[model samples]
Target: MATNAEIAGRFEEFADLLEADDVEYKPRAYRRAAEHVRGHPRPIADYVDDGDREAIEDIDGVGEAIADKIVEYVETGEIEELEELRAELPIDIADITRIEGVGPKTAGKLYRELGIETLDDLEEAAEAGEVQEVKGFGPKTEQNILENLEFAREVGQRQLLGEARPLADDVLAFLESVEAVERCEVAGSIRRWQETIGDVDVLVATEDGEAVIDAFRGWDSVDDEIESGPEKASVRVGEIRVDLRVVVPEEFGSALQYFTGSKDHNVSLRNYAIDRGMKLNEYGAFDVSNVEDEVAGQRVGERVAGETEAGMYEALGLEWIPPELRTDRGEIEAAANGELPDLLTREDVRGDLHSHTEWSDGNNTIEEMVDGAAAMGYDYYAVADHAEGPGIVGGMGLSDTEILEQVEQIREVDAASDIAVFAGIEANVDAEGEIDLSDEVIDALDVIVASTHSALDQDAETATDRLVRAIENPAIDVLGHPSGRLLNERSGLDFDATALGRAAAEHDTALEVNSNPRRLDLWGSAVQAAVEAGAPIAINTDAHQPSTLEYMRWGVHTARRGWAEADDVINTWELEKIREFLH
Candidate 1:
């Protein structure tokens, strides 16, 4: 059976191929349906398996034609149309489109003109100066393609946190159901919620390692078994590779700690343990203060801790560090000093500070979005649709007049709504850090989220200055996705996080950790810098549809990685407090 991500991924491919083939409106529909499909809480595959066509179509933004394709895909494990598109293009459409400025149409053009079918071919052409000779291709455009080709290759090598995390969840769900398994958890970058991960690492505790390993290897979701042993197994699930290591229940915690590592963090932790006359490893923590033979064996000293992860840290007289904070960025020292932050949890978030609807490129109505937020039990929500500005193609953003009109609609919705609905705009910060909105329009909005959607290639100093200028804007309540980075796609603006953080703090502007899987901007270290500077943070979904509102979970974990506490996040505040801050 296909996962939602897999099924949605198919639709996304379909959209790309359609666009590459120059089919216009259909590509948008397919893309919209893909977004909602990925966001839909229910398994679209289940409906198809049960022969429930009506239920499949019930998913928002899924129309009859697309739903039919989805059903065809779920039932047959392939969509005929998608296969036809793939055969027609016969190029790596997905990989080529990942180039920073390369779109589906551009990929199509490249293929038709230069016979470029892969990144290697494109790179070869660009290097030979052949790309610039092609129609519509300039030296700068060729340079961009060359610059981002490595990023595209890197993207193929790793998985986005959003894409990989769900697979981890499913793996855990299966592992937990095994009777022989005493405990199971994801480790590695996924555990720390890094924006991109190499693979999914799962640690299992069990007396019967063979049974657990067998169960893992035989799991239904396993697309291919790479290798398996009595104690461990590696399997492929779609594009994600999952590795499971089973250990004795007593050593589970230590094994988890050993595996859930940023190499630097583990190295520092091992040295820290050594300083305290303790030895830490995958087996357990042992007190070696009294041991005479320093290199006798692996367990030369008395075992002090191992049964539980908390005990492993507790034995060292430190607060058990949250996995997200295990980045070795002073976390061990902070733990020793009893200064580990009380990190924010999902429950601490009181409202969504950024979201969208049909007013822009969003797929839902304002009422529908507000209801979705209310359903999440939020005290408030902000409908900050994109405002017309740089890089906002297709006239998708709201014009000044349209923004006020939407404000009126938002006000009307707020009047009949159960929660406070704040009308806001995600205004684009231009090359020079100026917002596209007028002073009057800026003042009219309740909260202004200024972001950079263009000029992401600016040098560090220029980028930092641009962001600081935006932060200084009194009406700009939040600097959204301050760096504008897209995981595995583009490393956006190179800016000084500390400087940007301090500027935001001084201007009372909050920094946003965009929860969209592609853009967890202000990711970790950046957010940490902002929080350290006393600047507030907002974990927003940047949700374009109602179902995507659940992306807040990713955002919350991202904030934790940045060591943000509930108080550091503005959306965690009460309604009155947020209103006061906005004012």
Candidate 2:
């Protein structure tokens, strides 16, 4: 059955569509309730069944009217108001507006004016040059629509992080190999681990900016040149757009600082620089109309962004800000108070907590997984592929009998291997929050990672309650990817993290920071919140193949955003301590 969380999530999507369509206030109300319901601790249907709609009334922005609608939807499997709204619009609003620049209002307008209800219709109209005749849309806007429609049709969506990170590494390696380039770093959303990336931004510092630009355009992956300039160059590599920005060696630090931005962070920093009678840009900050009259914005003077990132901070009379903490979260305030938690580093990670093998869907076997971990210098590794249940598509997970048999093989590997091997299972959490594996089997494993694999459409209350129950289970060692979101592919589940984090802490269950670039689960803010609630984190690669084990760098970056320290992570502990944690 569709749980309360699932229903609420659908409503939330409808609400976003309504907002895009510039629907009435009720759409916003539904969205607000969806957010609140998704975050509520109790199962929403409890209140609905009890004839007390007030169950979620206390949810911020969810008043009596919205709660009653939720109750009505739960009982009858239909929300009257939503049905009415759909009757009026009755369009696949999300599909039409998913194009880069198209919003809900535009989608609605397009639908109403020209009956354009799908990407196909929009593309046909754009190609026919009929869209330029729309009320407010000009030829330029029509051109943009045509361009984006073609791009969207060809590329579908931004490349997944799993696919993009290795490409980033390859480019970085190539840039480093260039003798003229002094330093280089990835900047923008890819660095931020945003669910989707529009383009890949790379900032390079070189003695010869022109030579670096030429080299970038000549990159082996470059299939076509989009633009070539002294400081910046854009190229099309297959379908992905790679943008390279080159700066002089003297200005490298400033360029890095300017480029490695959360836009808002850079804006705030630039304002701070302006206040200090300086101008900050790709070129180093300069004293413009300064009291001391040093490096003016117009006339470049001396480099001040280097010496250390801290020096950049010293110039602004602020403490150094870590790249991950630059999200305009509490970093500025935390830096001011000198209260930032020392974030975890790759060195602090002693082992990988989650891996897979040929026994399940993984390409590598236990021995191969162990050797891969050992090569990466990990002291211990866990082989926790799918355990019999929902997530094991095509009936691939290990059955209870098979799991017991696998335990012996795992023991054999552990006994023979130099590094400690943890026998574990990635058990599925059913819609009701119950794990598929028996307690006897769960207890036998060194680690039990309970994950949600099916019925992803549950309401927030049901999803949260389901998860809360799973976390409370003593047999379940960690709640893997608490949100169950799969980047651009899927939004796994919606639940109250505050409640889940509390339950996890109460049960002493770790929350996984899944290191798979495609699924950096328990993302930055959630990790921070979980850490604050005293829930230890497990940075697991969930590696299906040997090559994937190295994706931990992106996972570490994700954790650092939460200001997670080595002490806050379970994998940072020694094998003995990790065993104690499991027990």
Candidate 3:
């Protein structure tokens, strides 16, 4: 059976092909299906083998045709349609399309017209005086392609948040050091803590926009300058392009509103502004009733965006929306109705349900991990070092006997520490759908988080069955990172979240939203699916080191993306409630 990655990859290729063909809505459909399949907790082959396409069709935007394709790929070990598309076009689609202005269609056209099938081919064509010879091509366009092709290949795709965040922080720090940059913030999906990031967008509020732009271009890390303007500057830091927008202090808030966006969310906000007799753009909010440029008799050609984020919201007659809640979810409606869920706050977390110490591969010691949790004002902490099973070849996992011995040590620490230290094991759910720890050891721990650590090759049915079996176990308190996904590296287990969620609800198992930036598993969509099925969630750090404990910010932000509230999460509960719920 083809892995989810393999199937998802082919779909992306098809989507890219359709995009090259300038196919519209269908690309979105295919892309959405690819995301759904890629994130689905079950193997695609199981549904195919069982002749149940309903599971695939049940995905949010997947329909019969896409579901059929998924099944066909599973049954035949290849997608014939994709093969046909490949044979027809047979261009090195991804590589050639990486050039800045080149889309799939442009790539296809260039390939068909100039026989430019590779980056090298395109380069050769550009160098050999072939590209400028094409119908709509020019010298500038060729130069731009030559300039961007290497970058496109180097960046490969959008950087995951894990990879881009440090660079953003460094830039933020550097910008703040600039005298002209009075205030600065990352304004984009990065601020929203989305799992994936395209370009790093930093918005600066400055008294002197030109000075700020000049300072940005000179940023130490900037390797190449893409474009420099009075208001905005784009630079390449390594392979990632960082866009810096400098706005006067007065227009800062408005610029932030314009830049910190999921475009769909911005579109909704802009319409909201329009309905209120105000026009919102990067410059500032304006009243355009009497002007052709959409701003007349109001703050046209003036700056007033940075007075306050609240002021911007006040103009729109809505509450200041938190960046995490900026997705075009229920926030707009909730803000309108004054019914926004009191979101889960960092302070609401009573304990870390999934953590590691020296007993496994974690960097911190047990005493230090407990002390850190206590220092953070947590009422309790569970040391969930890995348990031996399929994935543990040597030192990474604790044996059943070792885990039981650690339970005694946990009791010793619990007796001494001011905070409660719960003994738990991050037990591996083997390919055969069973957790490695024996019932006796499971009964001894205060919490048990069963997770997939091996046999990731299993078909979705097998993976889902494995996880569901563990979820059905009476001792398993939480299911860690439900999808086993590692950002930019691996996608998690292929379990049917709806089905597993139902099972979790029946068995009272919490699904973990791992906060580690690299993982961010049980993503917002999965959390929503689980919540819809009445399954409780646990926002955990899955912290390997003390510093990683702060990863909860990303997790909490991610959970809010799923519309998770205090009531939906176990960590958001008080310590007594947490213990009672687990008990």
Candidate 4:
């Protein structure tokens, strides 16, 4: 049976192809239906299998035409119209449009004009100066396509943190069930909470390495065994690659520290150890000061520290740094000076400032979302659903009158609820940096999250200026998803974070770290720059459903990776303090 993701992917491709074929309204309808399908709480396939076409059509933005296609796909595993369209185009539309400045229209144009059907063909055309010769495309455009080709090739290899972390948890649970395994942890970029991860790395401490390896290979989730040895193994679990390594209980701490590395951090620590006549590796930290043989291997000299990560760091006269802080971005120096930040944790988050309800492009009601927040023990919650604007489709954004009506409903819900509920709007920031809603409507809300939903391909300077203008708006409390990037799919904007951060700080505006797995926007580096510029951060889930509220963990870790302390995030403040800031 097809999952919602698979079905939504088909609809999205259908939309892209239709738009490329120059079809107008139908493409928007398909795209909107695709978005709604992707976010629907229940399995769309289940509805189809039950022979309920009305249930499928009842989904927001899905019409009868789309419903028929859904039934055809679920029953036959194919859609005749989509296949016909694919046969007609006969090009890799997705691959071609993934280039930075290229869209479906441009891809279609290039294919029609130059018979370009693949990235290789496009690259060939660009290299031969044929692209510049095409009407409506200049030499600079050709150069840009060439420049971004490498990035396009590297785009979809990594999995999002939200997708990878759960798989890691499952593997950990399996390993923990083994009696030989004394300790187990997931390391590498996942441990650092990078938005995208290449693979899941698991480290284990056990008396019997062979037993652990055998158990891992025999696990039910293993799809294919890539390689196996007495102490290590690599296997494919579902769509992700899982790498496992086992060490003795004595070296577990050192092994964990070594494997939970950003390569640069390991290099820096190794050099620091060399300077102090010590050796550090996966085995343990050792004192090589009195050793006669300089070329001696891993366990060659006196073992100075091997029991704990803190011991390893202490051997080098430094404090233990958090894994998220181990990116070699001055973390070693900070540790040496006892200045490592008291980073923000999941518990520090008091409320989410950007979230949605069924009022606009969400899966639940205002009361359901409020209950979800209260269940999470939040002191306050903000319902900041989409407001009517450009780039918002299928009537998903609320109108001015609708905004006022929703605010009244929010008040009624709050009156009966234990947790404080603040009504807000995720106002669209237009290309010129103006909010879409009227001033009267903006003033009526308790929280205002201004975000850019369109015009993402502006030049860096223009993008920076646009965000600066939005930050300068007194009514805007937060700058949502500063770059507007969607991990592995679109590079949303190019802007100067320093400029935007400085402007936001001056205007008392908070920059949001949007915690939706796909859009961990205002990513760690940007967060670091913004925080350094004296701008406060707000780690929001931007969640469309109640279950997604748990994504707050990803946001909090992303903030920690940015060196943000609890005091640096506005949402970590008490309700009165947050209210005061809003005023």
In terms of TM-score, the best-performing candidate is 3
lDDT of each: 0.86, 0.77, 0.80, 0.87
With a 3 Å backbone cut-off (N, CA, C), the pairs that clash in candidate 1 are none
Ranking by TM-score: 3, 2, 1, 4
Residue 531, model 3: Cα distance from true site in angstroms: 2.8
Q: Write the per-residue lDDT of candidate 4 for residues 522-557, one digit (tens) a residue.
A: 777678878889998999999899999988988999
Instruction: Provide backbone clash counts, one per model.
Output: 0, 11, 16, 0
lDDT of 1: 0.86
- What's the ranking of the predictions by lDDT, best on top? 4, 1, 3, 2
Off by over 4 Å in 4: 1-156, 292-294
**Residue 279 error for model 4, in Å?**
1.3
The residue-by-residue lDDT of candidate 3 on 1-583, one tens digit each, is 6776678888888998887766788877787667656655456666777887777788645788988888888777777888888887878888877777788878878977987778888988988878888989898888888888778777676687777888999999999899878889998999887888988999988879888888888877889887778888898888787999877787778778778876657777888877866777766776655557643443663333435666777677788887777766557777877776677777777788999998898998888899888888888889999988777677789878898888998999999999988898888777776776677886788888888777776656666777888888777799887767777677656667778778888888898999988788888667766877889999999888887888887788788877788889998777788889874
lDDT of 4: 0.87
Output the worst ten-in-a-row residue range by lDDT, candidate 4.
Answer: 35-44
10 residues in a row with least lDDT, candidate 2: 290-299
* Candidate 4 colliding pairs, count: 0
Give per-model TM-scores.
0.74, 0.76, 0.82, 0.74
